[model samples]
Target: QAGPGTIGRIVRVLLAEWNRFGQQVMMDGRVIQRGWRETQRGFDDRVGLFWRYGTGINLDGDDTDHPWSAAFISYTMRTAGVPDHLFPRSRRHSTYIHFAQQNALVNDPDTAFIAHRLEAYAPKVGDLVAYTRSGAANYDRYVNRARYKSHTDIVTYVHHGEIGVIGGNVADSVTLKRLKRGGAGRLIDDSHAWFAVIENRLPLR
Candidate 1:
């Protein structure tokens, strides 16, 4: 069960956080807060959504995957003493964050900060991870590697109390099958892919 009062309080806190630390815009000599916006990654064929406002944004696919987003939302609910199921699992292609109100929402740093903070409450497994680098230098290299060898995304599954993160130097990947199998097979010598046990279950927040 969710505490109706607490839920409202949490919403107010989040809204206030957005209004204060979030990005602001001046329109008609009035300062307005922006909450969040949908951002696209890949292209028409491999497009995905993330939330952004101002210069701060989190990408869904390349930023992190569905399971990760679920974990974050779950954590947030738990922190608010709400039922974990209140934050339902979403499809891989669905938006990471959704809102019933649009007028008060503006994609901005506050949304990104709060979302990124939720990872501390209810963590889960089999999440996609990404880096926040800005450049295209390695794009050609990754694409070429996938073209010449295998194409797969760098992701991992935390199964049976063990965590396995897949890493690959390939481009054009949308799944983690190859990184898992290859790492298990020892086909490659070293890997940026990482796997470890969850010693600490604390959420990022």
Candidate 2:
């Protein structure tokens, strides 16, 4: 079983890492302090996660050719000691977003888990918010793959109706982004960068 406060512990690790090196600067970690949120990939390489998950690809370094946000998420999960079978390791946001939806708490109510529609869900610490760049005119098209590229971030704090998330590869660094909800308590669809938030439920510690 995961230790007491396992979820909190994982979040703490992420927060601590952000505090130490996750600053917003172009190619920040190019010299010293080997870190993940650097211009070059730190220790969190993508090959291990993908290969472990049977992706058959071995990615190396912080190569721009290989986006490392997916690798970053996989690293977080590995550091948290989440089992391989529980999460899908991939470069695309859809790989895990679909899994979270399928395994949402609505389908399995006993576990402390759930996924919610981005426009309708409340921001929670440790929740994941996935966004598509598809420029969807409505909610229906937002989830489709016409435009298809996407990004995902981890929500870390909530206050006064706005939520803060830590995401990798923003402005070329690991940075904290603040998000505002619409008057109806939903994500505003007018934003260019984000379209949806997927809450990946964690088992109670």
Candidate 3:
């Protein structure tokens, strides 16, 4: 297994490639100017386009596989070119009920299992983005669809528009539940996973 600081090395390599991409953005005059001057944005979060969602495993043995956000950063890394061997394309049985149902596996299969392996892992600015729905692997189509009802996987660019607030909705469904119930209904509280880039702010908190 890789050491604890392995992720840091991965981040360094990713940033190197991103800086090259940034030059092109600058030449194209597409880079956005943040209001704050002391922050540095992240490549995955700052990419012109991005995505957000949740996947989970069994958290409380409640049989309910809710969404969590572990894969967000990992997927971003995979898409960003950390090496396919490092982050393979494995089918998350716990996250996708559809996959599990089709395969007829136990309801609570291994908490985290990777099915398909990837030959290459390089996340570009426009790669599809997803997060661990619930930090485990349990994610339902209905919940994911509802969470991302208004967005698409093809991200164009990160803007400070309404999406900034709603973008995080995918990770925290309660945010939407509250909005729908006139702020009166009890929200299904769940952990959130956020992957965003601020021009000057760091990506990982």
- Ranked by TM-score from best down, the candidates are 2, 3, 1
The predictions' CA RMSDs to the true structure, in order, are 19.1, 5.5, 16.7
Q: State each model's CA lDDT, in order.
A: 0.26, 0.57, 0.25
- The lDDT-based order of candidates, best leading, equals 2, 1, 3
Model 3: number of backbone collisions? 42
Question: Which candidate wins on lDDT?
Answer: 2
lDDT of 1 by residue, 1-205 (tens): 4544543443333333223323323222133433222122332112132122211234343443322322222333344454433333222111222220111134332221112111222213323322212232122222212112111121233343223332211121211222222323321212332211111111223
For each candidate, how many residue pairs have backbone atoms clashing (under 3 Å)?
A: 12, 1, 42
TM-score of 2: 0.71
In candidate 2, list every pair of residues with a backbone clash.
41-62
* Model 1: lDDT to the true structure: 0.26
Point out the worst 10-residue segment of candidate 1 by lDDT. Answer: 193-202
TM-score of each: 0.23, 0.71, 0.24
Query: TM-score for model 3?
Result: 0.24
Residue 24 displacement in candidate 1 (angstroms): 3.8
